[model samples]
Target: MNNTIKILLAEDEPSLGQIVKESLETRNFEVFHVENGEEAYKIYKEEQPAILVLDVMMPKKDGFTLAKEIREENSTIPIIFLTAKSQTKDVLEGFSHGGNDYLKKPFSMEELIVRIHSLLNRVEKIKDVEKIKIGNYTFNYKKQTLELDNISNLLTHREAELLYNLWQQKNEVLDRTFILKKLWGNDDFFNARSMDVFISKLRKKLKKDENIQIVNIRGFGYKLMC
Candidate 1:
């Protein structure tokens, strides 16, 4: 693991937050600790962290709200929720708001470290894949450009993100509703039409590559077959 991985920890409990913050710092993590959700969001913008650990039931904003607000800006930054509320609904709410992992309170330091490492490993893997090769084309995901026949075609932000989403689940059916919600933030009629337009645009862009096809799975979603 690289040294100085940043973590933004939001917990109202001084004892628990300090302990967690100091423990992470011991392992070379740069932690920005805040007592409330409002402050946490402020620090998050100032210092973008590799991961965020948010405790539910904070003063003012609350952890779930914080995660939702952050997700509006960044869809990929990993978030782990620390909450004593272990009900099914609570867990689902956390995930719906863009949390990647959830941990019940009273967790051990060792367990917390393991969860952090696990999430970070997944993030690192995604980060490693800056570019992906499709038949007769090279997609520079980081730069949102598709290169073919020595010509580079720049894609819009939505097009690039949608392509990346499909590519991540290559060869398998990528759910239509999931993609709609993920990329467009809603699966309503207008957004669905917008998604269809984008899909048509992608198909046209990749038409030159005979071996690559973005197949539409009827009533389900689209699949990237290569």
Candidate 2:
């Protein structure tokens, strides 16, 4: 529950890294500053920092490769690349590797701070929004809090995602295969069991909303009907 903004900074230039780290620290960002991409990756894995500020040209693993590895584990973490290469190809590659923002070398510290704050603000807004209402229940994906009319109920993460998907496909029979692929990343038996647990949780949450029910189509999939 320690929600402080954690930043992982990877910069090959010693002086610039020191300056950037000091500046970010002044602005209240908890920083783990590393000299190269290798150390950056190590710290990133350990800390799971919220924001990654990476340098493109670095020793050990390059920034693009590091970003790709990070993306594989978590698709939503924001990345910012600092590079001297301002070529169109380089910029395209940075974005392709999952960089959320990029800063050209010799950029002002003030501009960098502004960009970081902007990205953090966007993430906060996404997390702070209230539940989304569908049929008779409110689905609070952030808190995993589900409510039917006025009664509040707790939901696990997977359960919330399942209910959210059902809400998204209201009145339509969502294919079993599609839900499995989208949410579990596969349609294997283990994931199928996970899906069952979530379905049971959703059924309990929506019990009061008698009109809103999740109906199983057996051998096919399910549907959220109101």
Candidate 3:
């Protein structure tokens, strides 16, 4: 197996693309740089890059649309958009289309490197739990969304983390102290109360699937019954 991290960079500007590609190569990353999103997607399908850094404006296809297409097939891959536009709506659009991070134009190579590593770290944690089946719903840990009947319920960061923990020990008791320390850093009264609220919200979301249940093990913790 090739453990070396691969990066797919799609930037129409030849100079900037070469610079980024060389910078990543100098750091030992295998890079496949393309000038258009269509070729980028082709390389992505064949190469299976660990991370994607794409320009928002491309000739064949735009980054947002490319990302949406990629997300439909592979939701776990990390994507970073390179955009000159700093408009709020433009940034929101990138995210709405499934972008993990965005970099404004004229960004430093160092900043890009950091963003890549940060997103990669997060993906590594949830890679094993991607597309997990929970009764009638499909849990996307990387996207932090639960899908049922083609509708996806976006989850807050804490909610996703909590749900991931619960699913790890499905149908078995997961200690409250372990969850609090891992998630909230401590099991204080305030944090415990907040966890309860999240539990209630998760219960409501999963209620649509009659066969699935999150049972409370009094004096202990919770059990996910699917």
Give the per-residue lDDT digits (tens) of candidate 3, residues 51-160. Answer: 99999999999998899899788767888999998665676567667776677899999989988887788677665554989999999877789999999988654567
Candidate 2 residue lDDT tens string, 31-83: 99998878998899899898999999889989999998887676557688999
Worst 10 residues of 2 by lDDT: 153-162
Itemize residue pairs with steric clashes in candidate 2.
none
* Tens digits of per-residue lDDT for model 1, 49-134: 99999999999999999998987787668788999987656765676677766778889998789878876885676654567898
Candidate 2, position 220, lDDT: 85
Per-candidate Cα RMSD to the true structure, in Å, reads 9.0, 12.9, 7.6
TM-score of 2: 0.56
Model 1's alpha-carbon lDDT is 0.84
Question: Which stretches in model 1 have alpha-carbon errors above 4 Å?
Answer: 127-226
Instruction: Order the candidates by TM-score, highest first.
Output: 3, 1, 2
Q: Flag the better candidate by lDDT, 2 or 3.
A: 3
Better of 1 and 3 by TM-score: 3
Candidate 3 lDDT for residue 55? 99
Where is model 3 more than 4 Å wrong at Cα?
A: 1-3, 127-144, 147-226
